[model samples]
Target: MITDPELDGEWDTAERAEPAEPLAPRERAAAAAARPWLWALGGVVVASAVWAGGLYALGDRLAAPTVAYRATKNLCADFKAQSLSGITGDLRKRPVNKEVSHPAVDAAACVMNNVPDSPGDFYVYVNTELHKKADPATEFDVPSVDDLANVGDLRTEEVPDLGERAVMTSWAGEQGLNLKVLDGGAVFNLRVFATTFSEKGGRPATDSNAVQAAMVQDVRELMAALRK
Candidate 1:
């Protein structure tokens, strides 16, 4: 390598500076004025990108379920006190069932119980889950119903002419009845857990045929209520 030996081998000497010509007064004013306009143009470009991206984000949110939709549906709000009194069979003395909205599932549940604190015996629990699909409102049976079927006691099958789709499940020992009805884009489930307790701390068996007929009629009435 050829070496330069200027001032004891200092190779990268700084270049001499050219004197900057000072701007005229009018030119300085024009340059200052242009900076704000340049910043404003950049702001507009950023805002346009944000606005377009927001619309695409809104489209994604539109597919998610909303609590307002479930709370205002037929089951939650349509039935008056007198109507529920009939369906629940003289539980009218009970306070009005409050609408409970579940935002996560985009669903809601309205319940009335003979005993307020008790989840057992003589309660009507109506649950609704909304979906985008038109068919197959529900994919699986309620866990209790499936348990009975697994043990050879419950029969779960699609019952035509009930609604858009429905399943009737009845337990062999007849301790409880679970009926699921799928109407339109919502899946509605009615669970009735009613059993008389014998003096010996054992649950008395119910009339299986009577319970089945009554559950069938409940679904029928639910369909009628939705129509109204």
Candidate 2:
């Protein structure tokens, strides 16, 4: 019989081809032992993904609301500090006022003094901040009055029914009272400094009870006006 060259080559190649080697008994057993662990690892990954997704969804739903407080150019106009003045005296003809409007925060500060052209011994400092991209509640708990003022026998107290949370810190002498409130993303800080100087010396003229009450009331009214 005569065979074509191409057909002869094809038959030779087919005869030399070998089958794939099967897994060894030891290798098969190892793979079998690893299967459960691999499956457990995959299950853990999926569970973690689901848990992370749930937290992300919950965070979105519970995130703080956008700042609704409308900060005015003149906080002095928004809050007259009448309650403070009721004890100190009539506020000077013109209370010092400053305003800042920015994308990140809207801020204003007002210094009301009874003495004209001077920092009155008895005066109230008011400041407000409406944060657009941050929540003041996170860092509001850190007390600030001690750092800023001469705090002698400092006393800190919690204020209820005012805002999301509020705190008032009082000191014996020059540092009278510091009231800070966090409502949504808005931060309201009011400080009352009262003192009287005579030939002998100077002593704190502030009535903690009365000043604390007035500060709370003024803060409430100020919060209301800003919300409006």
Candidate 3:
């Protein structure tokens, strides 16, 4: 029953507390210094993860093309050695079209090499003119794998017995030639095809028939080399 206002004022004054000051810049800097490695550790972890992912993707893209090229190169070397074995002539090594060098060839080789007695049957086709002239009617035929049936009498020729599962085909052209080899499993079958056109009678001359015959003969000979 003492005066109510006087009692309330005293109670509030007695319960009041002072507010704390904010941290100073110096204090904050010291705190960060105490755990400096924490920030560096986080940055390193992030960078490492990013680098690893990038490498994985790059490897995948390169794997196929690299294999295809190597297989093609091997084919070229093998063909050059055997085709020009007896003949003493300078065989110019030139890069073939990228289309003929597909990534599938490498992927196929990877699988075929693992199999038992798997002969790498990589295929390549080239079109170049012979050193000598060829009759138009007697020229070779360039047949797509799908058009094997159109090869006519050439298809009936006995496929040379390559000791391993491999065959090579070469076709002659007016300006260039065509060559290919089949090895390993059918899946890894790499085919390299190229064509060159030479002018005859003021026009581009191509003997598809002669090209086909040359391909057959080249393949047959390649098989023989593989046997040795």
Best-matching candidate per lDDT: 2
- Tens-digit lDDT track for model 1 on 131-192? 54223333544454445554767767787787677786656355556778766556667666
- CA lDDT of each prediction against the hidden true structure: 0.56, 0.79, 0.36
**Cα lDDT of model 1 overall?**
0.56
Clashes of 1: 0
**TM-score-based ranking:** 2, 1, 3
Regions more than 4 Å wrong, model 1: 1-89, 95-105, 115-121, 133-153, 197-206
Q: Which lDDT tens digits does candidate 2 get at residues 1-228?
A: 778867776445545558878999999999899999999999999999999999998784456548878878889888877677676666646788999988888899988877767666677789999888667777887767454555456777899998999988877652478899998789999988776532112333556677788889989999998895
Candidate 2 structure, TM-score to reference = 0.74
Candidate 2: segments with Cα more than 4 A from true spot? 1-33, 54-58, 61-64, 145-152, 173-175, 197-206
Q: In candidate 2, how many clashes are counted?
A: 0
CA shift of 28, model 3, Å: 99
lDDT of 2 at 163: 93
Error of 1 at 166 (Å): 1.6
Quick one: best TM-score, which candidate?
A: 2
Could you tell me every candidate's TM-score relative to the true structure? 0.47, 0.74, 0.25
